[model samples]
Target: MPNLLIIEDEAAIRRVLSKILKEEDESYQVDEAADGVEGVKKIKANDYDLVLCDIKMPKMDGVEVLQEIQKLKPEIPVIMISGHGDIETAVDTMKKGAFDYIAKPPDLNRLLNTVRIALDRKELITENKRLKRKVSKNYQMIGESEAMTKVKDMIEKVAPTEARVLITGENGTGKELVAHWLHQKSERAKKPIIEVNCAAIPSELIESELFGHVKGAFTSANKDRAGKFEAANGGTIFLDEIGDMSLSAQAKVLRALQENKIQRVGSDKDIKVDVRVLAATNKNLKQEIADKNFREDLYHRLAVILIEVPALNDRREDIPLLITHFAEKIAKEQGTQVCTFTNKAIKLLQNYNWTGNIRELRNVVERLLILGGKEIDDKTVTQFSGK
Candidate 1:
């Protein structure tokens, strides 16, 4: 049931209004306040989906109540009710942030219609907020190391602004996690976080992948397609392993970064884009630049805020915590009870070389869960971990 608050100074008017709303729909749980002062108190105490307040009241007026509610609970929709002379005041109340207005001597149909519309609008606003939170949850970072802490701190500071970010780390070290953090903390979290692995795509197709192509632009371009940049409009685009991108593709990427414009591989028309580019690479771009394989200008452009993720070997202290996290996660995925690793097993894990880093550790933990006994021990480590 949707909670409704009616703020009318006159007790008789409040009762009549409540009766009409309930008759129209019993699903509405109605509460009444005699004056704006009492209405404000009720609003402060409980959360209501909709409020119906009269324009003129004693001790406080509807407009004052609306302003206070706007400060305290802006998401709750308010519909102002006006008397014969207060219709003009109700119009002004909307300027102060009222959802809609209904005239006094309440017209049943008008009240019902306005209430339905206001409730529907509120539902949409709430649903949009819920979806956005789900998007943020998709990018949850799962580490407690100092390296991750510093990366998170930087993301908090940089995500609000449109800054180019370059994430550097070894393979499986979670450079992509840094990129996700940047986008999730950003003002553009509501937008898509489009990811393109430059190394995965063939050099011949990288241009079309980043800038998109029109119909018949190339041999395989049967239809007009939007690329990563267009898909990430008003949000962020993450280019992974960018150092391995071809020189030809690098020039086009640099053009997109510098000019905020890109042309399709076989088309001459340029399209404007408003995208925040975040690039990551396992290779050393500075060395690649020295060899002339990577564009020096593009490297400088992308590295405005550089974040380097440390390898698991360097942060061995976090391995025990990480192991437990992955164990619980794997247990849930496999529909089994959470398993525990012995202290000796964790110590052995810390001593091993994590050349493949955190990604490798997660895989190793999953293997232990499946192959090892209820309690993962040092002997189980040697038997299954391939250490």
Candidate 2:
């Protein structure tokens, strides 16, 4: 149910607004405040989806109340009710933070529409906050080793710039995480960050995937579509496993980098794009260039700032921290308490070779959470960890 607050100095107007809101929807819980003081108190005490405040109250006017609400709870949408004489003041209040302004004799349709819009805006704000929390949790970088620390420092320094970043690391070393952090921390954070896995897509279709194709360009191309670069306009595009990209696609990508433009498959016209490019590959680009498997020009274009993620075996000291982090995260996902790992268990796990790196470690942690005892000892680690 949506909670609403009506802060009107006129008793008749207060009753009318409450009656109209309650009659409009049985789910709306409307509360009335005689003046601004009482309204501020109620607003501070409760969470309201919308607030209707009179612009010309005796104790404290709507503008003062809106200012207070801005300080107390800026998320709550406040609508200022104003008379003919207070119309200018009501508009000023909106500039000061009021969500909207309603006339002295509120129109039935206008009042209802305003209320609905305010409630919808409030819901959207709440949902966006929730999603931001989830995204932050998902992209959390967990490691305090020297190598990890250097990567973090580089991200801080380089993330603010428009320079292309090429992350180099072995498979499963969390290259994708670095790309996400860079986008999340950049000036283009508000825009989309489109990710394309070059290795996952077939060589034949890679060009069409990166640059959209017109209808009949390919058998699968039925209609015109926007490709990843167009979708990431005014944002960032992360090309993962760029070493595996075909030589033909590499030539097109190099052109896009040099000209800040791309031509769709089967189209001669070029579409200009403003996208910050970030690439990552597990393969050694120099070796790939030597073998003529990858383009040297493209590699140089993408590697303006190189970030090499350390293999898990090299950062064994961070295993304990990673274990605790993964344990808490897995517990939350599983709706269970976080299991503890004994010191001996930690030591044993750290000594083992992490062939698959952090990706493998997270899976092992989840497995232990399911199969190991409440306190995972060295014996439980040996039995379940496949060591």
Candidate 3:
């Protein structure tokens, strides 16, 4: 249902407007105000979707009322009702943030159409804000351990600069979380952050995947396609699991880094791109270079700033916080009651060998929440957490 308010000093006009709107749509909950003072008071005490104010009024004129609404609750769309002589003033009100204006003898179709459009726009704005909050919550960091503090401090220092970062950590150690934080805090945060799992793509197509390909470049190349570099142009490209990238593809990435340009797989044409590079890996790049499996030049280019994410076992102090975070997340996802863990249960979990790191811990937390009691305790941990 949409809530609407009409602020008109004339009792007869207010009654007729309210009657027409209600008959047009019974879902409209319309409220009336004798003057701008009463209207502003109603506004401050309620959450209205739309407001219709008359240009000519006493005590508080429509212009002053509109200004107050702008300062108080600007999101509510205000449509000015204008008399024949108030046409110019109505247009002036729009310049001061009025959504639109209607003439004194309002056209039935125009009044309803404008109201519907304004309500739709307000709904879209509310939905967009909701989605943004959800996205931010998904990427939230939930740790205050000394090791995590150092990593966060490094991010705060390096995020504002145009430096390439190489993040190294064991498997399942939340390396991707660090990558997301870096991108979100950078100057290019508004642009997309493209992630490529080098190990997941076949070695035969790695170059084309990173640099794109022209039509007829390969047997499966039916059409031209843009790759990660082109897609992330003016943004950040996160090469996850960089250790598994082929030696040949590494050469092209090296060129892109050095010259800020890339060539399509089967085309000699070079495309310039302004991209910040961030790479992550579980393997030792130094050892890969020594074994001739990785290029030393690319290592130097990407490691201008190095961030090493600590394994869960190394930061045991943060495990309790992580469990609570994961528990609330899982509960919300499953649409169930949020679960809590006893101190003994949290301590038991913290003492385990988290060889698979944070990823494995999240899985265990979800499993326990499903099978254990609402209040998770040491017995539940021992029985359902599988140590």
Instruction: Write candidate 1's Cα lDDT for 1-387 as tens digits.
Output: 899999998889889989998887788999999999999999999989999999889999889999999999999999998989998888888888899899878888788878876875576466556655655554456667787788778888988889999999999998887887788888887777778999999998888888887667878775456677876767788999999899998998899889998886678888898899999999999999999999999999999999988888888888988898889878987999998999999999999999999889999999999999899999999999988
Question: Each model's C-alpha lDDT?
Answer: 0.87, 0.90, 0.91
Q: Give the TM-score of candidate 2.
A: 0.67
Which residue pairs show collisions in model 3? none
Alpha-carbon TM-score of each model against the true structure: 0.65, 0.67, 0.66
- Deviation from truth (RMSD, Å), model 3: 12.0
Q: What would the per-residue lDDT of candidate 3 be over residues 1-387, giving only the tens digit for each residue?
A: 889999999999999889998997799999999999999999999999999999899999999999999999999999999999999999999999999999988889889878876775576456445544654778877789999999999999998899999999999998888888998899988776778999999999999989888768999975466777877778888999999999999999999999999998899999999999999999999999999999999999999999999999999999999998999989998999998999999989999999999999999999999999889999999999876
Clashes of 3: 0
